[model samples]
Target chain A: IDAVCTAHGLSVAEFHALRARATEAKTRAYCPYSNFRVGAALLARAGEGEGESGGRYVLGANVENASYPVTTCAERVALGTAVVEGLHSGNGRGFRAIAVSTDAEGPASPCGMCRQFIREFCELSMPILMFDKNDTFIVMTLGELLPLSFGPDNMGVKDPAKP
Target chain B: IDAVCTAHGLSVAEFHALRARATEAKTRAYCPYSNFRVGAALLARAGEGEGESGGRYVLGANVENASYPVTTCAERVALGTAVVEGLHSGNGRGFRAIAVSTDAEGPASPCGMCRQFIREFCELSMPILMFDKNDTFIVMTLGELLPLSFGPDNMGVKDPAKP
Candidate 1:
């Protein structure tokens, strides 16, 4: 935990908080259809003028619709809420790490859509922490999860993730 | 508005509000990638003990991700929020109508994924209202949008829409 946190610029508190809260968020999921529950917690990067030590956290659980495609995954709900709440991405300000918790035996990764969504506001180097129900976990950077990602730069639009 | 509202059991006020709100919701969309903005509103089934005439309205706009597939349609966002806020789908108590507004020349219907999500909560007869940028519109039932639907009943689960 110490080495991982240090390497990712996350504090021990942030790491633990993400895991615990993501687990807790799963209980709030309204998944009567697939009966699958997922929870996500996002750690924001520190704002300008502040050292890159402390940041805020946002949480979301999978919100499924009977229409499977309409379901918003845990990572997305967190990202949407963050965007609406004014967590801008650009100029080195954006999310630091994302922690996701699920009830599977193996660590559950973000789906394709979520990988795309995260690409909008997170850096290629942002760490994604996936935790299985047993607390066993694996981590990957955003670049590895979604290779050759398309973004604002692709469309010639100025975007935070580009820089 | 009056004719369609009467046919769908929606009052003129309700129908107009749905259109206006859905259109308004489109402005709040975070679609820097696709440059396409969409909005949706859902009318809840009336409360138990009350006739199936009036229910509350929930709104959501398309929240886009840099990844196109992860881009959530406006329809799903509304449904997810409804579920989180304690709306139940059964016993004539799910959504009665869904309205979508987009800035296209023709009416923009909910995507296939959204159709499936609606299936989880809506009755077959539920009407879907589509509005173009000019508010010129079309309407279809959930059944028509997605025929031969699959539901919780397929998995041997007792669900309201299934019965």
Candidate 2:
């Protein structure tokens, strides 16, 4: 755990917070159809002038609609909320890490759609932590999860928020 | 236009409103990435005890992110907003019709993902209206857009909002 934190520039405390908060966020899920609750926690990257440890956290739970495709996943909900709050990618205001929690017996990673969504704001090296019901976790980088992913740059779209 | 309205059970005024509102909603799009704005309007189905004319309209525009996959389509945005406003499927609170507007030269259909999402709350027979920049339009039923779809019932999940 210590080695993992050092490699990702996250302190032991932050890692613990990600797990606790993600688990807590699961209870707020609005999934009555699948009953598969999912929660996500995003740690912001410290902005300029702020110290390395100054990042904050944002949390979200899955919001499901009767129309299955209308559902917003936990990761997306968190990212969307963060974007609305002005913590967008580029301009040195991006995300550092993301943690997800689910009740499955094994650690569950973000879905294909979510992986693509995360690629929009996070760097390829960003760490993704997935926790199972028993709190067991596995970590992977965003680039590994969604290899050869398409993004804004692929379409020649500049980050509108970047100076 | 009158023939289209008669076939769809929409009043002429409603049809005009759909075109105007969808076009207006396109201006509210947050799509900095695509720079391709899209908007949607949904007309609700009158609930039980309410007359056929009691249905209301909801509007949404595409919300994009630095991550292309994280962007919410205009159709899903409108549906999600409607679901949060207490309009859902299987409880007599379903939708009557949907209209989409894009600045493309020709009328554009909803993407495959949006089609799947619409299938969740709308009846297969529900009409989807697509309008191009010139106001020329085409209409197709949800079933025609997404044939042989998978839904809550296919997974044995009853509508939680159903009485």
Candidate 3:
């Protein structure tokens, strides 16, 4: 765990906090339709001049609609809220890491759509932590999860919000 | 137009309002990635005591993320907002009609994901109106857009929010 923390530039305490917060966020899920609850926690990259421990956490739980496709996943809900709050690629403020929690026996990663969503604002090397019901976890980078992903540059259109 | 209004049980004024609202909503789109703006309007079903003309309109515009797949389509946005506002199947207040507007030469329909999303809260016979750049239009039923779709009942889990 120490080696993993060092490699990802995350302290052991931060890692534990992410897992705990993600698990707690799961209780807030509004998934009456699927009975599948998911929670996500994001570690925002600290602004310049802020020390290594400056990163703040943002959390979200899945909000499902009767229309299955309208269901916003936990990761997306977190990202969307963050974006609305001025933490997004367009604003040049991006996330450092993300953690997701689910009740499955094994660690469950974000879905295909969520992987695509994360691709937009996170660096390729950003760590993604997946926690299972027993608190066991698996970690991977955003690039590895969604290889050959599409992003802002692929469109060849300048972000209107950017200079 | 009169033929369509009669066939769909919508008054001519309602149809016109949908077109105007959807077109106006397109101006609020935040799509910097694809540069393909889209807007949507929903006509909600009135309550039991409310008259046919009591239906209210809801609007939404596409919001794109740097990651292409994270982008929420206009139709899904309208539906999500409607659900959040308590106009959903679980509350017995579903929508009666939906309209979409885009700048394409011909009318543009909702994407596959949005189609699936719509299937969840709308009846099979619900009408979906599509408007082109010139305001020329085409209309189809939700059933025609997404045939043999999977929905809340497919999982055989009774909606916990429903009786």
The TM-scores, one per candidate, come to: 0.75, 0.60, 0.60
TM-score of chain A of 1: 0.91
Candidate 2: residue B112 Cα off by (Å): 1.8
Q: Which order, best to worst by DockQ?
A: 1, 3, 2
Across A1-163, the per-residue lDDT of candidate 2 in tens digits comes to 7888988888899999999989987876768778899988998877777786658787877767556666888887677556544566544778878999999999999998888877776788889999999999999999889888777777777643334
Segments in model 3 whose C-alpha atoms lie over 4 Å from true places:
A1-33, A37-71, A74-163, B48-54, B158-163
Q: State the lDDT of candidate 1 residue by residue for B43-139, as single tens digits.
A: 8877677774547887777777544666777887777666644465544567778899999999989988888888877878888999999999998
Q: Per-residue CA lDDT of candidate 1, range A1-163, in tens?
A: 8988888887788889999988987876767778889988888876777775646787788876544555678887777656644465534567889999999999999988788888887889899999999999988999999998888687676666655
Docking class of 3: incorrect
Tens digits of lDDT, candidate 3, B49-91: 6676657887877778766556887887676555544566543
**In angstroms, how far off is B140's CA in candidate 3?**
1.3
How far residue A154's Cα lies from its native spot in candidate 2, in Å, is 7.5
TM-score of 2: 0.60
**Fraction of true contacts kept, per model?**
0.38, 0.25, 0.32
List clashing residue pairs in candidate 3: none
Clashing pairs in 2: A67-B120, A120-B67
> What TM-score did chain B of candidate 1 earn?
0.90
Candidate 1 local Cα displacement, residue B158, angstroms: 3.6
Among these predictions, the greatest lDDT belongs to 2
